[model samples]
Target: MEFLEAFFGVIGDLTWGWALIPFLVVIGVFFTVVSGFVQLQYFGRMFRVLSSKNQSGDPNAISARAALLLSVGGRVGGGNIAGVAVAISLGGPGAIFWMWAIALVGMATSLIECSLAQLFKRSEGDGTYRGGPARSIIHGLGADYRWLAIIYSVCLIASFAFGFNAFQGNTVAGAAEESLGISRIWTGILLTGVTGLIVFGGIQRIAKVADVIVPIMAVGYIAMSLVVIALNITEVPGLIYSIVTNAFGFEEVVGGGMGAALAQGLRRGLFSNEAGLGSAPNVAATADVRHPISQGITQSFSVFIDTMIICTCTAFIILLSDVYQPGAEGVDGIVLTQQSLASHLGGWTSYFLTGAILLFAFSSIIYNYYLGENALTFMTSSPLALQGLRIAVMALVFIGATAPSATSVFFFSDPMMGILAVVNLLALMMLFPTAKRILNDFRAQIKAGVDRPVLNPDQFPDLDLDRTAWTGKIRENG
Candidate 1:
């Protein structure tokens, strides 16, 4: 395990350097521009679609709100809180600016990939939706790319099972031990039990739990952090100043210089939203909205809420509390976050943070399982294969609980996510035209006084809807 981890670490570092970051940026930027910045144009529509309840006869995958809830459940987790702390500790408060920048582009990336996923999502015998790069690769790029899709599936499954799920569990246990006196074993047992109960219930169950819990936990944490900021309101401007100026290396931050700040910021931001990494789109494709782009727009807002709103709140809590001065040794991971909050809210805050971490970790475990399950379906449709995969996933969740080192959690996670991002970005580039056409048509209809948004893949003669269109659009204005 040591040898393998080291190898993955080296590879991950090499890819994570200038090569992958620029590649992700370029692809995201291209799509953002190509779609005429749909993230901005249709931003209001996202809320409208998410807020509206679906009628009983909607033939879509899941309710728009449910899909948003699930996607929110997946992205808004330990990464937002703990990961933000790690960014500040390693890269300084300056990292927060770059995180916001990445998320800005990441929203565009989310829109593109999610639209593509909807284009090719499958309706299984169980009456649920499953899609991602694997489905898009096969549907758009043809069978020749099926091999590429298989490789992607294997890597995605490995990422979620060994990297994401394990890391989420370990973070919960680590936070518990550091903040409270609980052992990792006890933490893992509690988490594993919670995960088992929710995961077995599938998307509807997961979404229901998320719809209630995600908003409450997120708003609660942010509210506490807001009080902390109010207590130290004087420092807010300086913190913002530090984040923006330091983003371009105008001022020296932690480690050597600007490079460290950029790396730390991008790493934390990417992990927080999992935008270009392609994981969210798996859940996004399952939405019950009338059009894939509708769900796509809603999900784009989710990325913003996860990284910009929630993660930023956590960052402000830490910086405002002044937990780390320039010359002081930094706190690590969730412990640092717990300490920061404790400073504002006292010891009881630590226990609440621990519980929040557990919720974050548990929801992520179920979501990670869904991603892996979809990947398995992309590779093979065999029921036995799926059954075996479920059992294996559950067993790994148990294994994740017992893993002692957070370092090991990161070692497994970083590389697999990098690989998944590369594959997803590649698919997004190929399907950009489809995304563009849909955005244009949707916006044009709204401009022409069409109250309802209709996107029929079959109606588009020039574009092969079968290849890239997800939902059947309304035939006429009612």
Candidate 2:
């Protein structure tokens, strides 16, 4: 186990530090430029789309808003909390600035990939739609690129189910043990059991659950964070100053200099908001939006909320407390946030955040499970295979809970996430021409005074897409 962890850690470090970082930044910048800064162009429209109805009246099809919530729930987890702590501990306050930078670019990257996913989405013929980078690759690019799609699916499964979900379980277990004195093994078992119950119920059920949980937990956490920040409001100006300075101030940072800040910020930011990593599109495609851009723009908001709002909240929570030393390399992950919150509020805040961790991490576990399950469908449709995967997911949750460290889980996940981002970004680049056309069609209609713009299949005759999905119509449900 130690050897595997060490080996993967080295590979993960190399992948993110050397290959993926620059690649992510360049591609994200490219997408942002080519999309005409769509993230900003449609920033107001993002809110407007959230109020629109689902085009498909099919009972099983999710609304764009539900998809947004699920994506947010998936995004808001150990990564937002523990990952942010880890970044600050290892990189310094400057890492927060880098995280903001990545999200700025990632917002556009997400818009492009998710919009393409909807354009190339497939109807499951069971009142469901599905798509992602893999769907975009195979359908948009053709059979010759089927191999690439398969590889994307494999890496997504590895990242979400095997790697990301384990980290979720590990964080939850660690928090439970530290705060409430629960045995890690017992925490693991309880988590696995609860996870199994939800995952087996399928994505629709998961969406319903997310609709309720995501808003509640997110608001609760943010409200608590607001209290902490308000109590220490005077320190915020200096906190922001340090975040800027340590981002470039070599002498004040614990983790050496700008190098650590950039790496951890990009890696952890990608993990948290997931703008370009290609996981959210799976759920985004499931939304029966009138136009692909509707979901795409709304999905971009997830990155803003995850990194800019939620992650920044966690950072403020930590930095506002006396427990956090700017130059000292102390705790990371849930423990640091929990302890810091406790210091600011009271000892009870530790237990409060333990519940937050459970909810946050559990949402991600199921979200990752669904992504893995979605990926497996590209490989095989066998019930037995999916069952086997569920078993493995459960087992992994247990192992992560009982494991002594999250290092192995995180190390393995980092490389897998880098791989997913690489493949998905490549596919997005290849499919950009088609994506541009699809997005343009939406822009033209909206500018022409169409209150609720929809995709017209006839307009996109050259592209092969599910007619059911691009019907150029929306049902007005009063």
**Top of the candidates by TM-score:** 2
Per-residue error at 106 for model 2, in Å?
0.7
- TM-score of model number 1: 0.91
lDDT of 1 by residue, 1-478 (tens): 7898789888688767546887877776777777778788777776764444442144333666777777887888888887888888778777888899889888999988887787667666454677777888887777888887887888888888557787777677777787677887887777777777776776667777887887877778788878888988998898898888777778876765577677888878987888888888888877645566767888899998899889999989888885755313555667778788888879899888887887777778778888887788777779898778767666666666676554364465667777788887887777777777777777777899976666766666664344322446452111
Worst 10 residues of 1 by lDDT: 469-478
Q: List the candidates' TM-scores in order.
A: 0.91, 0.93
Clash numbers, per candidate? 2, 1
lDDT of 2 by residue, 293-411 (tens): 87888899988989999999999998788777654555667778888999999998877888888889888888899899889987898999999999999988988998957536456
Error of 1 at 37 (Å): 2.1
Model 1 alpha-carbon drift over 4 Å, by segment: 1-3, 54-61, 125-127, 253-255, 327-330, 403-412, 461-478
lDDT for residue 149 in candidate 1, whole number 0-100? 87
